[model samples]
Target: MADATHSTGMIRVWDPLVRIGHWVLVVAFATAYLTEGEPEWLHVWAGYAIAATVALRLLWGVIGPQRARFSDFVTGPGRAVAYLRDLIAGRAERHVGHSPAGGAMTVALLVTLGVTAFAGMGTLAAEEGEGPLAGIVAQIPETDGPRAYTGDHDEDEHGEHGEESAWKEVHEVAANLTLILILLHLGGVALASARHGENLARSMVTGDKRA
Candidate 1:
């Protein structure tokens, strides 16, 4: 049956650029998330790589193949909700490319990951006096005062540090949110695979399904 299915000409749904972008983003995101703050260079460079990957993906979404374009898959939120409802009821239709819910997840993941990476850049600039925003973040004022407090000098010093802390917190929150989205994405893939009776994850690797 498997051979017979393959005998009929199958459509090439996922283009090479799409597949490559997907896997590279997976690796880049993993590297950035796992390293976190320590080994600052590794985390920072990983984030940069992710940013580049996403930029290319955004471009591809505009000019890629028929199945790769955002217009090919992206649908309204109402459609995504209806798809999810059918999915839960075990009556969802198999999509040659991305289903409505999957399309929604894809958009959400791309936007959130981009936000997370950009937030990291801001945090790096503010806290480490480095990254793309460094010039704009203004270096924290140096303090030569005694252990005791000075009037506005102390406020100025602490205020700079506080701004850095705020950026760091925003970065952390964005990263954590990305992590949650990833988990939800995996769950959606598993459910879709089971319902469709096809190995969706393996299809991503081979860029071919039972079509």
Candidate 2:
């Protein structure tokens, strides 16, 4: 038997589900950010969409295709250190899926976004004076900052937003961090596509490549 050779770096990477979740999250994030105030209704929809996309992704990370699954790429610090060394030497092996560093980044981004989404929701509820945990949160300490989930929705509650301005600031910070991660992710894709002669972005769309 002989090994197979791809015409280009067109071997499939992301599955259909993975691609859908990726785009859904992207659009949701962008829409949420763009329509934050003037068109608040659209912004709220975007936030909900982002949260839903995260839920879908959580499922996919567990049972999706080999490459799409979290186990395929996530590595510990030791492996990450080695992967970095290889990259610096320009001798890094090209992975058909996400590189180890990319995997860590993905996980970080996912967890952060999930937290932001949930927290944002709480803030919104509090703003409406009917937060899910609104009654309970009133008891949190207000001296420090937003409590883990006190839900008092009171300003002085250790972690309550107490005001819309505070919520907006936190939301913006998370959004900015997300934007940076997205840019980094795209840059890495561009680099990989060029190095491997792959249309990484295109594969995410049609869910098919030379492979």
Candidate 3:
């Protein structure tokens, strides 16, 4: 399907893998975020789904169809900034694949989501001695009873506590950043759709755009 384009005036810009991965990320991220770490099973699984989807998407970006390849759309930050400027001026060009700004957003989303998911895993490992990072990230000591808070802690214990706190902070900050990016991405899509007189979101669903 690498060279697949239609003769009905529609071009197949996104392949099935890309489309599925995109939506999977959307649903998984929403589930993980909305659950807010409650119902631990659901949250952990949702996060795992997100991480897996992102890894697959990154692989696809390297070996998928032409339009799906990072080479086809990924551009420098300056280009993305210029594209945004043009978009705001209502003079941006329509792209069969992804515009410079859209490409940049795609990279940003993937990286941020990866960080958020992995950081959550680290937090889990440190707090519960679970996840892939278990035994790698220092696990908090388990206690059978409520322990008294003595202001005494070894340097190693203090370091472990700091690591756990850092992981939690990273997870929270990255998750919040992903939300901000998602809002910006949606706004960009809306603006581009209006400017181009096309349903960009619909194109993603159908995996095609006007040729």
Candidate 4:
């Protein structure tokens, strides 16, 4: 099935769920990245959304339609390298779904975003003592009894046990790496677009590409 296009034929490649999830992750990651350390609530919720998206994507990769499944586009590292070489040499094949290198980049981005979300959650629990793990992370000591589940404990009280700084650093590094991955992904899209004479980025929205 071809989508109407002036210059080239198009095919249904990306499914609606895949398209929606991809854009949602893009927005959620961008929101979290831009609002990091400013609005705690926004950051937390964004991270949560990212985590949720990753989960859905993982599930989709397992049981989704042909092009959306991991078995469909994922290739060996050798294949990915060959694809990159072809891309650089201007001989890359135009794929209806993701190309070999693009598939690898998708996996990398998903994993990195998942790690970023996890680290962000840990950081929130350790630093502010408030998150899904709040009750277990930064318990406050009572005057004459066992520690309370309140997250308002003094930072100094938990000390290294909280590992607040460490978790925060991990979160920051993961976020930065995710951003770098995003930049690389965009660059690859531009290069592929020019090489194949197709708007690869827009393909995600319409779920079709030159066929």
Give the per-residue lDDT digits (tens) of candidate 3, residues 1-211.
4545688978778889988899999999999999987788999999999999999989999998888899999999999999899999999888888999999999999999999999988877766667887766753444222222222432465575322356778999999999999999999999999998889898889898888
Task: Tell me the RMSD of model 2 versus the true structure.
Answer: 6.2
lDDT of 2 by residue, 63-94 (tens): 87777788888889787667656765667776
Error of 4 at 65 (Å): 0.6
**Which stretches of candidate 2 lie above 4 Å from their native place?**
1-11, 130-169, 209-211
Per-model CA lDDT versus the true structure:
0.78, 0.69, 0.85, 0.81
Off by over 4 Å in 4: 1-8, 135-164
- Kindly list the per-residue Cα lDDT of model 4 for residues 1-211, writing each as its tens digit: 2333435466778889999999989999989999865676787898999999999999999998888899988999999999999999999887877899999999999999999998787667665566775565555342122232233444556473433255667888989999999999999999999998889888889888766
Best by lDDT: 3
* Candidate number with the higher TM-score (1 or 3): 3
Candidate 4, poorest ten consecutive residues by summed lDDT: 142-151
Model 1 per-residue lDDT tens digits across residues 95-178: 988999999999998998888888777767755567786766664343211122112333455566223355667778888888
lDDT of 2: 0.69
Residue 211, model 1: Cα distance from true site in angstroms: 1.8
Assess the local accuracy of residue 75 in candidate 4 as a C-alpha lDDT between 0 and 100.
95
Q: Is candidate 1 or candidate 2 better by TM-score?
A: 1
How well does each candidate superpose onto the true structure, as a TM-score? 0.83, 0.74, 0.86, 0.83
